[model samples]
Target chain A: MPALILFWILAIVCIGAALTMVTAANPVRSALSLVVCFLALAVYYVTLSAQFIGAVQVVVYAGAVMVLFLFVIMLLNLGAPVTSSTKGSNQNTAAVALGAILLLVLFISGIFFEIPGKAVSPATAQAQGTVKAVGLTLYNPHLPWLFPFEATSLLLLVAVVGAIVMTRRQV
Target chain B: MLTGLVAYWDNLRDGIYRLFIFPEYWHGIRLPALVPYVALAGIFAFTLGILPMLIWIERVVIGLMQDRTGPNRLGPRGLLQPPADVLKLFFKEDIQPGSIDVRLYYLAPFISMLVALSAGAVIPLQTVTFRNVHGGLYTVPVTPGNVNIGLLFMLAASSLGVYGIILAGWSSNNKYSLLGGLRASAQIISYELAMGLSLLCVVLLAGSVQLDHIVNAQNTLPFGIHWLPSFLKGSIFSWYWLQSLIVPVVIYTVAMIAETNRAPFDLPEAESELVAGFHTEYTSMKFATFFAGEYVNMLMICGLNASVFWGGWLPPFNCFPFTFIPGFVWYILKVMMGIFFYTWLRATLPRLRYDALMNLGWKRMLPLALVWLFLLAGYSLVRTATAPHITPTAVVTVAHVAPGR
Candidate 1:
């Protein structure tokens, strides 16, 4: 019951921050709100007993990613109020339309889809979320996950190389 | 008399267990629920109480290094100087720069202080064992948060600390502040990689991410050599600093120094260049908050180093004299040694050139950490593969049929 209460509170905060991120005119404020949203989502992950995911979320998104975003915003001097040149761009209308469609899709899926696995007990979830359990699941030779995991890492390596190449060309 | 004193100590320990560990209900209210809050308050008091003394120690140590008498006034050799300085800061005029981001400027120092303190939550100072009602002994780590993911939590919190500096720089509307903040963010991000990698070496050796388990893993014979003298078992020799062959510890120390923006790695607040860096525009209590936050961060990181690399609360030897002292005292001593190391470096070394700092972090430390990580992984793999395995005896069992069949 206490977990349920905490979940609801975090849900509200997460959604509120997401909305603020969308509406905030200043880029820095928007980035900061996005960080708040990410943090709230991390808490939600923790409440779901996925502690590893929650920590990684904070470290990757709220910590590293958002800091870079703020750096770009500051370097570009984009914190100033939006000017009249883009006042009637109709971007907001397009965003609203796309958001409505996305919400509809989410609602339809939530109502119609039945997940394949049985709902895990809190104890099982906690056990599954441990570093050992996650590592075994990811790297076990018999499991299908190993290939995809290695592939994802390879993709990241490629991305790093690509970034280096792009920057070196400019230099 | 010694037995009576021991019994009294045991009673006090049990009382503490009741209060913090297996909290009992009182007046129909669950007491366990208050443990986190109580622990948080304790951490706050402990860190804040030590902040003044830390400042004084730093001054004295630096003065000693520079061949001068430090703080010889205001309560015995300038011992009262830190508190007086804090009081003065509290009473001084709070200055607000014109055309600054008012809300964020006010928010920055609090963010810095809060993040620094929150990182202290997962650090286990000591472990205690107590007898339960059933007369069975249970050991619990005495920490604010003993979560399985404690190390990761610390990393995450330290990463978040960049925001405070970045925001302080951007909201201050000062060029120097902006430059300082930028340097801090980049430097921290770079060093964090090496720090995390070095810590991963410990985690790899311990096979656990929890700090308590990491410390416990070190309480063994050095290199698992049974031939060593009994006193050497579970001593400093077994600690990660030596166990990991000194490389990871060295890398972690350098990375931690950079992470905290200390001297020799303090490009962010290079007063000679950026004029106090990110907090250039901050004044009075706000500046004091930043100052206090920096010290607290130093303590937190040092505490981590102690626990992760220096055998934590474990005594230096498995002997009567060393064992007589409590674990928390050793913990504090190790942490203080870390602080002294910081002051020593500050007094001994000049600040690194900006490019030199970047090169050291990216080119030197990062690669070294990565190579060491691979080496340790390979070593552990080989060790596991070569270790003797016990063979099980064969057994035969008959399948039982249903009774009717």
Candidate 2:
């Protein structure tokens, strides 16, 4: 019962913070809201048994990433009013409509796919999810995923090259 | 009595297991496992509470190194200095600049403290035994979550800490702050790549991502003798710290120093140039958060270096007749040593020029890490190929043959 209440509270905070990030008039307020969202996400990660992930989420996303974003915004001499494009064309509206539809579909599907309950069974859950278990999974039957993972590196490399090229110009 | 004790032990073991692996089960029985939660709360408290003491320790150590008396007023040898400083900060009125973004400024400190505090969760403070909420058995772990993705998780989070400085700098709406933040973000991102690759050598060697497994692998040498194990009759030099890959470890340590923005690399908060850098505008408790966060980063970096290069909590012994100290003690001791090194560097070295910092990171450390990683991978391949092929009978024959022959 307490779990349910705690989860609900975190969920509310997550959604609320996310919304604030979108609508907060000041850029700093938006960043702060984002931190709150990250905190909620970290809590969720904890509940999910991704303890390391949870800690990282709090440390990196809430602590570090948001700080950088805010730092950049502040550096640009930005104020309460960020450079907003009210040049919202029909295309922007259409995109928003599509996003809303997608969200609705996801929300409705969640209601329909009621998962059958499976408890941790105590002993098994305890022994599982260690670094060893994860490594075994990553390098064993799911070893095929390693290829895609390495391939992603190529994508990142290309992106870096592209960024450098774009940023640089002939003197 | 033994049976009762055994049953209690079993229950505790089961509970801890459920908590990490079957988080859903953990969620289900969390109410009943309030004791474990409370214990976890204590760990967080310890992480923060000890940091201030570390700061004082750093000052005193640096003073001793420099042949000066440090913080001698507040309690014996200034032992109570940290508490006094904390009390002072607690009472300082938060000063909000008229021009700055109010929200980001306020949130920056909280972000710093949160990041610093959060890293403690996955760090094994002490080997714990607890009652399983469901199985009525012990669900304890010798090591926490032994997760293969431990290094990756740590890398990702450390990378994120860069943003905190950047945000603090940007939100302050000062040129120095903005510059500091930008430098910090870039520096962190660049060094993190080197740090990850350096540890990748260690990962390649052990062929395992779990921290405990790496330590175990290091406990035995390549030729089969535990070289550094003085207590054991015939163990020889087997620490990963002394491995041929120690080059990469050194590079990794340098990168870590840069990543944490300490000493020579601490340009973001360079007082001479930036007038306190990113958090210049910060005052009172908010400033305290940044202060605490910096120390926490120092701790996390120290712990990471110990875990990856050193045998983390593993003591320097082949086998002790009687084990007295715990794993946590070794881990903490190693971390303190790392911190001591950081302070020593700060006291002795001059801050590098911005261009020099950038150059050293990109030109020096990065290349070394990349080269070392490839070399380690090659070595691993060679080792694997050289190992004699053996069936189950051969394994048994070899084991018997060694003693008999």
Candidate 3:
């Protein structure tokens, strides 16, 4: 019962903050809202018994990376309520239409799929939530997935190099 | 009927008593003792300032190590210097540069402190006993969130500390801070992967991710005998650090030093190049906040290394098995040793060039970590296939050890 209440509270906060991130006029407010969203996501991760993942989420996204985002936003003087003259109303309409379609598709899928049975509570899941479980999963039957994990890291490397190149040119 | 009423009255009395004094009633049942989370917080807060105290200590030590009086005017033999400097920094007006984000700028310090504080949660403190109303005794692990993911959480949290410096640099509206932040982010992220992998080697040997479990697993020396007896017999004892893990430890130490952004890897604030780096525009308390954050991070990283590589809260050798030196003392000593190393490096080493820092993290640490992890994992595989399966609890009990290490 308590889990239901907590999940509802966190889910509401997360959705509200995500909305605020988009709607806030000031970019700084938007960034702050994003931080709230990250925090709420972390709580949700905890509810899922992904304690390590939740901690990683906080440390990497909220603790370190978000600070960097905020720093950039602050450095850019994004606190000001800036006005934009360029407004593509047709583009906005199209985007909204696509988003609504996607939502509809998800709803249809949810109805058709009828979701799987609920998993055990986090307390019960603790038995296999250790680092060993993650390692075993990473290496054992899921060894094929290793190729993609490595490939994704390679992609991150390329992106990082690209960013450095772009920024260095400016400097 | 009277006897039944009397019993009913007794039941009602107990119910009312429990409703009013629930905690007291609950105490009647044996439960795990609570780790003093506040005590951990207090100690972490204390360590945040130890860097400056370390500065003072360094000066005193250097004076002792060499032959000179370091700072005599601030107090009797310059004892008051750090506090005075801190006071001056406090009174200096905080400057928010024009065209910078104010909220993120202010938040950088809190994020840094939070990461530092979170790292201490997994540390084991002294064990306590609790008695329930039924007079049953229960033993509880004193570490907060003594879940199996202690080391992982520490790594992730320390990784988060990088953002504070990155954001400080980027948000300052200064080129120096931006460059510093970028370099630090790149450096820290790169090295953290290696640190994670290197620690994985030890985790593989222990077959568990719990820090206490790892320490306990180390208690029995290699080949089913103690290290001393093995030494007398001219056979090496099997602590993971001594047995095929020397390379991993070295890799771990190097990556850890970089992770903490200390000395040679102190790229974020290379005054020579970046003019105080990320906090270039910060003044007064803002500057102090960044300073305090770095020191706290250093302490945390050191504590983590000690816990992971050195048997954290584990007394050296079984000289006093059941000899009760409290767990917190061992934790403190290990952390202090790490701090001492940081101080030693400060006195001895110069900052590395930015290119060198990046190259070391990628070219050296990452590759070494990868190789080391595979070796450990491979070894574990061989051992597991050949050896019989041992449940973690059975191993613990057979080893004749306490759960808290």
Can you write out model 3's per-residue Cα lDDT over B80-145, one digit (the tens) per residue?
988888889889987779988677788877777777777777765434445556766544545666
CA displacement after TM-score superposition, residue B261 of candidate 2 (Å):
1.9
Please provide TM-scores, in order, for all candidate models, with all chains considered together: 0.89, 0.75, 0.77
Question: Against the native chain B, what TM-score does each candidate's chain B reach?
Answer: 0.87, 0.80, 0.79
Measured against the true two-chain complex, the DockQ scores of the candidates, in the order shown, are 0.45, 0.20, 0.27
Question: What ranking of all candidate models by TM-score puts the best one first?
Answer: 1, 3, 2
- Predictions in order: lDDT: 0.84, 0.69, 0.69
Query: What CAPRI grade goes to candidate 3?
Result: acceptable
Model 3 ranges with Cα > 4 A deviation: A1-5, A20-36, A55-86, A104-123, A126-171, B1-31, B36-52, B62-68, B75-77, B126-139, B222-240, B320-324, B382-405
Q: Count the backbone clashes (under 3 Å) in each candidate.
A: 2, 34, 10
| lDDT (10s digit) by residue, model 2, range B183-231 | 7877786677777778877776665555555665665543333343344
For model 2 the local lDDT of residue B83 reads 90
Q: Quick one: best DockQ, which candidate?
A: 1
Q: Interface root-mean-square deviation for each candidate?
A: 9.2, 9.5, 7.8
Instruction: Name the best candidate (by lDDT).
Output: 1
Relative to the unseen true structure, what is the C-alpha lDDT of residue B77 in candidate 3, on a scale of 0 to 100? 81
For the predicted complex of model 3, DockQ is 0.27
Best by TM-score: 1
